[model samples]
Target: MTELTPREIVRELDRYIIGQDDAKRAVAVALRNRYRRAQLPEDIREEVTPKNILMIGPTGVGKTEIARRLAKLVDAPFIKVEATKFTEVGYVGRDVESIVRDLVEAAIRLVKEQHGRQVRGRARAQAEDRLVELLSGATKKRKSANPIDILLGNRPKEPELSPEDRDKLVVQQDDVRTRLRAGQMEHEIVEIEVEEVRPMSEIPGMDVNMNDMLSGIIPKKTKLRKVEVREARKILEAEEEDNLIDMDQVYTEAIDRAEQHGIVFLDEIDKVAGRGGGSGPDVSREGVQRDILPIVEGSTVNTKYGPVKTDHMLFIAAGAFHVAKVTDLIPELQGRFPVRVDLKPLSVEDYKRILTQPENALIRQYELLLGVDGVSLDFTDAALSAIAECAWQDNETGENIGARRLHTLLEQILMDIAFNAGGGDAPEVTVTVDKEYVEKMLGADLHRKDVRKYIL
Candidate 1:
């Protein structure tokens, strides 16, 4: 972060997004401020508050992409939430504070990924030892034979073993260990005890008991299975890893990292801004915004994991404020977002750049998609211009959805080719959708004002 200037950040963002320079620059400056704050005195650092950003733009205009890319660039904990998904407290729906919890989870994952890399070498050695033990059954404790052994009918007799016999037994044990490590006896079956654990879903939306409240009452049973030596090694290695990791420590560091660097991107926030005060849903929308105000303004949220502070954490909120203005949000909530950047709608040149310039351009995306079916898709330079012109015209005629218009325009243009895709094998397909082709497809309809009014 210290190494990157705001201009460099914008440069990185430009690779993926076509335009929206204002929004990109605003976020870049906000991010750089975070790095700047870190260099301040400790006492002053605590006094510094993050300047949250509110991005207003239509969908597919790089609002979400900018926030997402910003987090990726900084390697920070990031999450995106829709404003409509949340409701006021006491409501049956999700509470806005859940976004903070989700951000904490993301932070934990990031820290865990870093920690895993740090512990890889040590973990590998431990895994190898566990695998070797599984292969040779060394984990089983050896019991000393009783000296009264020769007791036949309660009569005790002194039994002596020859030195050579003892030496031979030691040699045999060593040879077995050597063969086990050398993969010479990998196919040999050995009895191993494995715990019987019930399978459960980890998906959040699914009906699964995450707390495992009944686990204490349900006794764990052991099952013995005869598995090949090599296969058993892998199973044992995983068990060993589980034993080595310290959950308490991981959770502690995760919470700290989350509090420090987690980022939450709240999308469609204007929906919850509310139009002054109204009844039913509209009233609750304002209530939801009020509830979220404190969290965005820097407050501690309690999660099942632990209490996490949101102070100093970056919050990037975005919305398509076509209906409600940003000012409609409660003053407290609006104040929380000190920085605001509005994204501009795309132009024909912007659409053209999107179709050709980006690494994942529309042309490249279609080519890759069709290439799976042993089909090669090639779009001529003129075809791109035609596509952009038609898209721009449609936006002028109807509701402007930014870059999303391209998807509709491209799909309409290639409908016939895509529909008859696998019918027959052709030698090659070269399509040049010039101005003439563009007129041919959309000519009559585009000229008709009523068609533009309705179809568009």
Candidate 2:
């Protein structure tokens, strides 16, 4: 994050999201500010907060994509929530605080994965050793773990073997270990005990997780199942990694990471923009905004892990603002989002660039999807122009869905070819989508769109 200057950030963003330069520059500064704030004095750092951004644009534009990509670039704990999903207090709807809870959950998973990777090599070796014991049927003896077994003297009674027999058993186990390590016993079946998923009782409308509450108090139960050696090794390896990890450290670091570096993307915020005192469906719009205001303004949210501070966390709100303008939202919520950027409607050339540019371009995606079926997909430059023109014309005539119109157009054009590929052992085929083919397939739809201009 420190190395990513505002200029470099925009350059990186260009790889996936095209255009929206204003939006890109706004987010770049916002992201860079987070790092800048960290360098301040302890007393000064507490006073500085993230300049939350509000992105206004039409549907299918790059609003959410920008926030999502920004979060990924920094590897922050990110979660996107719909503003319409929550309601005002007294309404039976989700609370806005759940946003922080969910963010913390993502943080926990992220930290666990990082720690798991660090310990994976050691865990793999240990799991393989256990697998060899299971496969050889010359397993080592272990003490009983259950208190009932200790109390009733119900432990397994073992027959004492002579030293010569034990020596012979060791030799046999050595041969089995060598084969197991050599990947020669991957298909062999083994029986292992896997932990069962814990079920917990919970009451409705509660924020607390009942399962998490009882996790420490209840002892986990395991059941034996037969699985191939390859699959068993994975299960055992995961358990071994769990044993190696310090979960308490994970919990502590995760909470800190989420509190300091979390990103909450509030999408469809325009849906909740309304002046107060309205009745019926729009009554709760301002109410919802009022509720979201506190979180963005910095508040403490309780999670299963611990309390998380929203002061340092970044909040990026986006909406199409087609029906309700940004001014329609309550002033308090509006003030919380200090930075605002408007994403321009995609042009025909922008659509063409979107279809071809970016690391994960639309045309490249379709090509890759079909490539798995041994179908080589290619699109002529003229075909791309035709598709982009169709998308632009459709947006002008009907819904202004920005770059998303390309997906609909391309899917319709390639529907038959995708359906027919890889059904059986057929020779590889090459499909080049040309302008004539696009016109032939979408002629009817394009004609209908043309007719829409005549409607009013």
TM-score of every candidate relative to the true structure: 0.74, 0.92
The digit string of per-residue lDDT tens for model 2 on 350-434 reads 9999998999998899889999999998889999998988999899888788888888998899998999999668888899889
lDDT measured at residue 350 in model 1 versus the true structure, 0 to 100: 91
TM-score of 2: 0.92
Which 10 residues in a row give candidate 2 its minimum summed lDDT? 275-284
What lDDT tens digits, residue by residue, belong to model 1 across residues 1-456?
445899999999888888899999998888888889888999999999888999988887888888888888888888999989988888888877778878877887777667666666677667555545555444553243343542333433345559996676556657776786687878988767788777863544222355355555544455777898777776665565556667567778878777776778999898887764455446787888988888988898876567889898888999988888887888888889989887888888999999978877887887777665556766767777777877777676767777888888777776766676654565455544566665676666445342455554
Clashes found in each candidate (C-alpha, N, C closer than 3 A): 0, 0
Highest TM-score, which number? 2
Candidate 2, residue 126: CA error in Å? 1.4
lDDT of 2 at 116: 96
Model 2 C-alpha lDDT versus the unseen true structure: 0.86
